[model samples]
Target: MKLFVNSLSFLLNVSVVALVVGGATGLAIIRDHQERLPSIEPLLDYRPSVRSLVEDSEGSPLLSLGKERRDLVSLDEIPEHLINAFIAAEDKNFWDHEGYDALAITRAAVRNFGAGGVKSGASTITQQLVKNVVLTTERSIERKIQEALLAFEIEKHLSKDEILERYLNEIYLGRGAYGVSRAAEIYFGKSLSDLTLSENAFLAGLPKAPTRYGLDIEQGKGRQSYVLSRMSLENMISEEEYAHALAAPLLISEGDNDTEQDQASHFVRSALTEVESIVEDAGDALAEGYVVRITQDSDLQGALEKSLREALIAYEYRQSAWKGPYKEDLPPVDSWTATPVLMDGDSYFVSINGEPLPLSKDSVKFANRGEFTLAPGMRVLVEKVGDKAKIRQVPDVQGAAVAMDPKTGRVLAMTGSFTQDGQFFNRAMDAHRQPGSLLKPFIYAQALEDGWSPTSPILDTGVAIQSNGQNEVWRPRDHNFSKSGFVTLRSGLEYSRNSVTLRLAEAIGEEKIGNLFEGMGIHKKAEPGLSIALGSQESTLLDLVSAYAALANDGVPKRPVMVESVSSKDGTVVYEPEDFIDEREPFFDEVTLAQIRSMMAGVTEYGTAWRAFEGAGYTVHGKTGTTNQARDTWFIGFTQNLVVGAFVGFDAPEPLGRGESGGSTAAPIVRAFFDQIDETYRISDYQLPDGAKIIEIDPDTGIPFDGGFKEIIRED
Candidate 1:
C-alpha cells in the first residue's frame, strides 16, 4: 500500500512538470505569432498589376502591353457558376473554413508522408489569398504557419466576398494573364460573365497548374473533368448540368483572337514606342491603369491589312508559274500538313496527305493570300473555301502602308509590315528607302513655285551630264526608256517623265529643290545631283506621306500624329498631345499649290496610276514611283481629306522582277485599300481656291486654245 501511494505521488509530480513546460512553449509560440504577423490593410486593398490598354479614337480597345495582362472585375460581375467551380475545385469547404482546414491538413499530411515528399497542399481559399498577396510561396513549416496566421487576420478584417475577390484577381492564370477575368478573355476570348459552364470548369482547373493546362486544352480537359465531377458530388451543380459540362467539348478560342493578335497589332506596337517615351515608367504606367488614346480607325486598319494581303497575293499569283505539283509527303487531309504550290489560271494546287489537290476557283477566291503564298517550299494552311480548297501562304515578303487624315494629321491606318505577330520592326516609320518617282511631285511643286506654269513646255528628250564626282557621263531616261520631245510640264509630271523632271530640277537649281523637299517634311539630306529629282535621297514612308499631306492640305504642313492623348487610372489627364500650329507654315503660295494639285490630279486621270481608280468615281491626286532596276516601288497620293502611302520591295533591295513598276505593283495595293473605305470617308473632289482660273490649253504647246480641254490655273 505504501509503494502504490509513492508511485501515484511521482506520477503527479511528472504531470505537473509536463504542464509547466508545455505552457511555456505555447506562450513562446504566441509571442512569435504576435511579432511576425503583418498588417492586413495592404492585403485588403489589393492592387494587382495590369496592362495598359491602347484604344482607338472611337474608344475601342486596340491592344494591351505589359508583363501582367490582367482585367480587373468586381466580385459582383463574376458568374455564380464560375465562383462555384473554383470553390469545388480548390476548397469544397471554403465557406466553413476560418483559415486552414484541419481535416484537409491531416489528410494531406498523411498522403504526403506516404508519398515520401511534399505534394498535396492543405491551404484554404483564405490561406491562398494570404500566400498570393502577403506571403511567399516557399514551402516550409514556418511559411505555412505564417500564411495561416495572416489568413486568419485577413478573414477578420475583410468580408468573405472581398477575400474571394482579392484571391481571384491576384492569382496567376498563365499566358501572361493574371486573374480570372484575364484568363477568361485569354483562353476563351470571353468575359467571366460570358463563360459557359464547361469554360468555367476549365478555368477553375488552371490556378493549380496554369502553364501545363492553359496552353494545351487537351491536357486541361482531364482536370476540367475532375472539377466538374467534384461540383456534381458537392451538389453545387445538378447531375444533368454536370453531365452536360462533361460531354461539352472544350471550345478554346482561336490563338489570334486575343488583343495582341488583333487587326491593330502593328499600329499598337508602333504606338508603344511613343507610349514608353511619354510615360514615366511603361510597366508601372500600365499597372496603375493608364489608357493610351491613339489615332487609329479600327475598321480602316482592318481593311488596310486585308487589302495589303490580298494585293500581295495577287502579285505573287501573277509572278508564279505552275510547277507541276508540290510532290511532297504530307499529313492527313484535315491535319495541318498541307503545302501550297503555284496558282495556275483557275486552279490552286496544294499537297495534302501526300496527294496533290486542286482547289476550285471559289475556294481560292477569298483566301488570305498575304498570309499564304505560292513561294516554292512554303508551308501553308489549307482549308475549304466555299466549294473550293483554299491554300493560305505564310507571308514572307515585307510591305508597309500608312494612311493619314490630311486635315488633322491623324493616322487613320498604319501597318509596318505584312505580318506583326510579334515582330518589332516598324518599317513604315523607320525604314529608309528611295522614294523613286514619288519625289517628282515635290519637284513639280518647286517648279510651280518658280513662276513656271504647268502649261510651260519642257524637253522630255534624254540629256547626258557629268555628275559631280563620277567619271562616266550620267544620262537620265524615262521609265519606259522612250523619249517624248518637248512635252509641257503637265505632261512631264503626268507621264512621270524622268528626263523632263531632271531638266526642271536643273533649271530651278538642285539646292533650291533640296530646300523645297525639307520644307515639305523630308528631313533627309538631298544628294547634289539630278537623281534627287527622281528620289535618289532615302526617306521613310511616313515622311513622304506627310509631305503629300501638305499638298492635300492646300499649303500648310501638319505633323503626323499617332497617339492623341493619355490618361491616368483615376481619369486624370497625364499627357495630352496639343496641335501646335507654330510649326506649320505655308510652304507654297495658294495659287502655286492649286496648280500643283491640278497637275497631280491629271496623273490619276490619265497617267500611270490611271488603272488604280479607273472606274471608281472619286477623283484622287497621286504619283507612282519605281526605282532604278525596279528595286523599290511606291504610290503616295491624297484626296482633300486623306493621304495614303504604300511601298512594296524586298528588304535587301532586289529587283521585284521585270515589269513590276510602282504603277503595276504598289498602286494596286493603294487602290484595294481605298476601295474598302466607306463612302462617307471618301472625298469626292478637291475644292478649288477662289483666285484659280480655268483656261483651255493646247496639248502640243504651252498656248491656251479654245478647242482644248479646260485646265485650272491659279492666279494668286
Candidate 2:
C-alpha cells in the first residue's frame, strides 16, 4: 500500500514539472516576439502642430471660430494661479505620476468592474495628454496597453514642464479658444497676465467640459454664477471667494483700446481670412502655429473714425436743406447719412467711415444700453459682454461708406452706417442699386473708346433705341424734363444730359457698352436696353470703387486684396502675395479716360458736383447722380491722391426727402473727407496728358458756329 501511494505522488510530481516546463517555453517565445517587434516607447511623446488662422492684431479669431480645435500655448506662460486651480479641480497629483495615479485608477477600475460597465476614466493630465496626443479615445484592452506604453514613453523623453505645457495648450478651453491666453481674452476681457484668482479658477474649471462651464452671453449673470459654483465645489476657491467673485462685476480691462476705436476689426478680419487659406493649404496642424503680420495703420484708422463722425454731424445740421441742380425739391431733409474714405494711393492703406444717423437701428440698440441717444453729442458706451459684443441696437439708418487705394484696390475703410453702433449693413458693398447719372461717365468713356471725343455732336432730342431682340421703344429723357437738340457732348455731359447719354449709348452699342463697364470692374449685368447709359443697372460700392480706381489708374485695372503676407510663428514664410504686378487690362484707352476725367472735372468745377469741389482748397473731380424720386444719390470722384464714392438713401427705397442729389447729400461728405485730407497731403488736379487739348464750343449748338461753347478738352 505504501509503494502504490509513493508511485501516485511521483507521477503527480512529474506531471507538474512537465506542465511548468511547457509554460516556461511559451513565456520565452512571447518574450522573444516582443523583443523582435519595435518597442512602444516611440509612441509616447507626440506633438501635433496646432494650426491657427491668421487673425487681426486685436486677436479676434477671424476664421469661423469653432472650426480649428486647438490653442497650444506653453504651460509656464499661463498664470501659475490657473495651473493651481486646474490641479485642485482635476488631478491633485498630476506631477510625480508615471502615467496613471494608481490609487485613483484602481478605485475607478474596481468600481467599474463591480458595476459590469466602464465608468468615468481616472485620467491624470499626463494620461489625458497621452490619449489626446498619441491615441484616439477608444475602448479596448489593446488600446489601453498602447496608451499605457505611450504614457511611459512620454515620461522617458519630455520633462514635466514641457509635457504639461503641451497638455495644457492642446486641451480645449471652450469658446473656440485653445490656450490660456485666448481663454483669458475671450472670457475676462483681459490678458493671461491680468487674470485674477477667481478668473483663473473659472477658466481652470472649463477643461473638463467647456460647454457646461462656458458662460452664455444671453444668460448673463446666471452662467457666471454657475461657473463660480463649480470652482468652489472643486476646491479651487473657498465658498466665500466664490460668492465674492460671482457678485463681482465682469472684469472689463481699461485699455482694451484694441477695438475701442473700430481701428482693428478690418485688419483682423482680413488676417483671419488669410490664415484660413494658409491652414487649408498647409493642413490644420501646421497652420495653427502660423503668426501673421499685417499692415494695419491704427492711428490712421482712428483719425478716419473721428473725421467721419464730425463730418456726418456737420452735414446733418448745416447742409440738411441743400438742393442740387437737377432737383426742384429743396431740403429740410428727413434723414440722411454719408461715408468718406481716405486711402494711401501707393500702399492701399485705406480708411473710411459712414457716421451714424439718429434714426438708425444701431442707434436704437445703443440707446437701450444708454450709449446712444436721439440727439447728437450723446455719450459713448465702453463695456464688454462675455465672448460677444454688448452693443446698442443697430439703427434703422440706411447708408454705407467705403474707401480704398486707387493703385492697389486695397480697401482702407468700410462702414455701413455713420455710427459704429448703428446698422452693419455695409451699404458700400451690400447694396446694388441703380447709379442714375453715375452711368453717364461710363457712357462717355465708352464713346471715347469707340473713337469719338467728348466734343462729338449727339443731338439730345429724346431718342428710343430698339435693338438686341429684347427692347421695346425706350425713350430716355433728361432729369429736368427738358431736351437740347444740338448740345455738344461736353456740355451735355457736364449738365448730365440723360437724352445725350442714351444717344451716345446707341452710338457705342449696348454690347460694347456692357463690356466697357465690365472691364472697369462693374460686375452687375446690364440689360440689353437704352437705359443702360442712364445707370439703370445695379452695382455694389466695391464694384464702383474698383471701377473708379481703374479710371484713376489710367484705365489699368487691378483686383483688390487686403493681406500682404503671412508666416508661421517660427518666422517661416507661409504666404506672400506676388508683387502687385498683376495683369492690367485697359478698361478704356488712356486718352479716353483722360477725356472723361476732364469732363467729370468740369462736373466738379463748374457743373453738378461743384459743391464738393469749390469749397475744398484741394482740387477735386467727380460726378453726381440722382435717381428718379431721389431714391438713390451718388457722388463718384477722386483727387490726384485718392478716389472715393459716397451713396445715400432710405432702406426701403423711399423718396429720400426732396433735393437729395448726389452733390447735396453725397458730395458734401466727400468735401468733408477731402477737407480733412488737404490738411495732410498735397491735393492736386487729375493731371491731363500734354497732348490733350481744351477747345471751346457752343453750349446749345453742336456746331462750332461760335466758340460760345464751354472749354471742352479732347485728349489723343
Candidate 3:
C-alpha cells in the first residue's frame, strides 16, 4: 500500500512537469511567429513637403463620384468639444480604461447576454478602433477575439493620442464616407478646422448610427439636441455650453462643393468602365482607388444636361397639345430633333446636345421575362413628366448621342438619351443605320485616291448597275430624282449627285471602297452598286464621326480618349491614356484629304448643310443624309476643334412624316450646340501643322490652278 501511494504521487508530479514544458514550447513558437509577422503600412504615405492635390487642375477631385466623401482628420485636428461629445456618447471612461473597463464590460455583458441577443457591445474605444482598422465591421465572437487581441497590442504600442487619431480617421460616418473630417465636409461643406461646437457635436454623434441620425440627409433634427444633452449628463460639457450648442442652427456652407462627375455622370461611368477594362487586362484590381482624370469639362456637361431636359420638356408639351384630334387628310409634317456629340480632334473632351427619351427599366425587365402579357398600346406609356415622375400613354422612345476624339479614338461625351434611366446603348458607338448622301465623302475620297482628279468629268446622268451578288440592277437617283449634266468630281460631290457617286464607286471598284472604309475602322462591307455611292453602306454614328474627324485633323485620325490618366492613391501612375499607342494607320493621303475637305466645304457653303453654318455661329462643315423612307437621317461634320455626328430616326421602320431631311430636321440641333458652346465651354482654335502647304485649286479638281478654286492645304 505504501509503495502504490508513492508511485501515484510521482506520476502526478511528472504529469505537471510535462504539461508545463508543452505550454512553454507552444508559447515560444507563437511569440516567434508574432515577431516574424509584418506590420501593416498606413493607408496613405506622406511625401516630405510635396504638394498633394486633393483636386485636379480644374479644381475638382480626380474622382468626385457618388456621394461626396468627408475629409480625413486626426483627433488633434478636431476640436475638443467634438472629442468630448464622442467620448460622452460612446464610451465615457475611454481615456482611463486599458482597452476595457472591467466594471463597465461586466455590466454590458450581463445586460446583452440576459436578452439572448447582442444589444450592446462591451467594447472600449480602443477595441472599436482595433476592430475598424484590423478586423472587419462584423458582429461575431471570432471577430471580437481578433479585435480584443489587436486592441491589447495597440494599447501596448501606441500612446493615447495616436490611438485616438486612428480611431477618429477610421470610423465610418456614413454617406459613402469613412472618416470624421470627410463627414464634416459632407454635412457642413467645411473642414474640421472651421467647425463650431454645434457642428462638432453633430458630426461626433454620427459615428454611432450615421444614417439613423439623419446626418446623410443633412436633416438637422433634434438628434443634435439629444447628443448635447448626453454630453451634459455625462459631465463632459457645461450646462451653458450644451444649451448654446443646442440653440445654434445648423450652418452648412454652399461652397464649391460640387462633383467633377455631376453633369458627366453618364460619360464618367463609361470612361471608368473602359479604364477598369484596361486595368483588368494588366491584371490589376480596380478597387485599389484608381484616380481617373477624364477629359470632360463639368460646365459643358451641366449645360448639355440642362438643355436636354428643357428640350425634352418642350417636346412633351408639344405632344400634349397634339392630343386634341387626329386629322387623316392633313399633309404630313415631320418633327425631328438632332443630338450632336462634339469632341476635340486632339483631346476627347466630348460635348453633346439634343435630348431623346431612353428605354425604361421596367420595359427592359419585361423584355427579359420569358413570357409576359400587356394591354394594347401599353408600351407607349411611361413618359417622364418630371424627375421621378412619369406620364402614362405617351410615345416615349429611345435615342442616343455620342462624340469622340479624332486623334486617339477616345470617346469624349456620350449621352445615350435624354432620360438616362437605364444602361447606356451609345447610338454613336452602336446602331448601324444607313447614312444617305452623308457617305458620299468616302466615295469622293476614293475617287481622289484612285487617280481621279477633282476636275475629272463624272457623268451625273442616271445609269443602271448590278448590286451586291444578286444580279439586281439598281439605279440610284438624287434627292430631286433627276440627273445633272457633266460636272467636275468636286461639283458632283457638292451637289450630292447619286449617279456621279455611283460612277465614282464603279471607277474605284466596290471592293476597294470597302477596303478604304475598313482602313478608317469602318467594318461594314460596302454593297456593290450605285446605291453604295448614295451612302447605302450601313454604318454607325461612331464610324461616321471617326471618318469625319480624320478629315478635320487634315487626315490624321486620333482615337478618342475619355480618361486621360489614372493614378493610385500614392500618386503612382497606374494607367495612362498617353502610354497606349494606336496602331491603326491613317486612311487618307494629304492630297486626297485636301480635295475631300474642299468638296465638304461646299456642303456648308452651297449644299445640304448650308443652314448649319448660317444660323448658330458654328464653324461647322458637314454633310446631311436622309435615307429612303426616312428610316435614318444623319448630319456628320466637324468644327475646327471637334468632330460631331448627329442621327435621328425611328427604332422601327416608319415614315417620319414629310420633309425629314437631315439638314432641316437635325441641323438646328447642331446649331444650338455651337450657339451655346462659348457660354458653357472654353473656345479652342484649329491649326494645321508646320509642313501643311496651302495652295489654290479649282473647286472642280485637285490640280493646282492659278487664281482659281479654293484654298487647299497639302500636309507633307
- Top candidate on lDDT is 1
Over 19-72, each residue of candidate 3 has an lDDT whose tens digit, in order, gives: 223434434433443344323233122111111122332547644433334355
List, residue by residue over 371-453, the lDDT tens digit for candidate 1.
Answer: 43344445555644444455444444568899998878888899877666544466788789998899898888878877888
Query: Any idea how many clashes model 3 has?
Result: 18
Q: Per-candidate TM vs. native?
A: 0.62, 0.55, 0.52
Q: State how far residue 193 of model 3 sits from its true place (Å).
A: 47
Candidate 2 has a TM-score of 0.55
The all-Cα superposition gives candidate 1 an RMSD in Å to the true structure of 19.2
Q: List the pairs of residues colliding in candidate 1.
A: 371-393, 372-392, 372-393, 372-394, 373-393
What range of 10 consecutive residues in model 2 has the weakest lDDT sum?
A: 346-355
As a whole number from 0 to 100, the lDDT of residue 343 in candidate 3 is 26
> Whose lDDT is higher: candidate 2's or candidate 3's?
2
lDDT, model 3, position 604: 72
How would you encode candidate 2's per-residue C-alpha lDDT over 154-196 as one tens digit per residue? 6767777876777666665544556667667766777677887
RMSD values, in order shown: 19.2, 18.5, 20.7
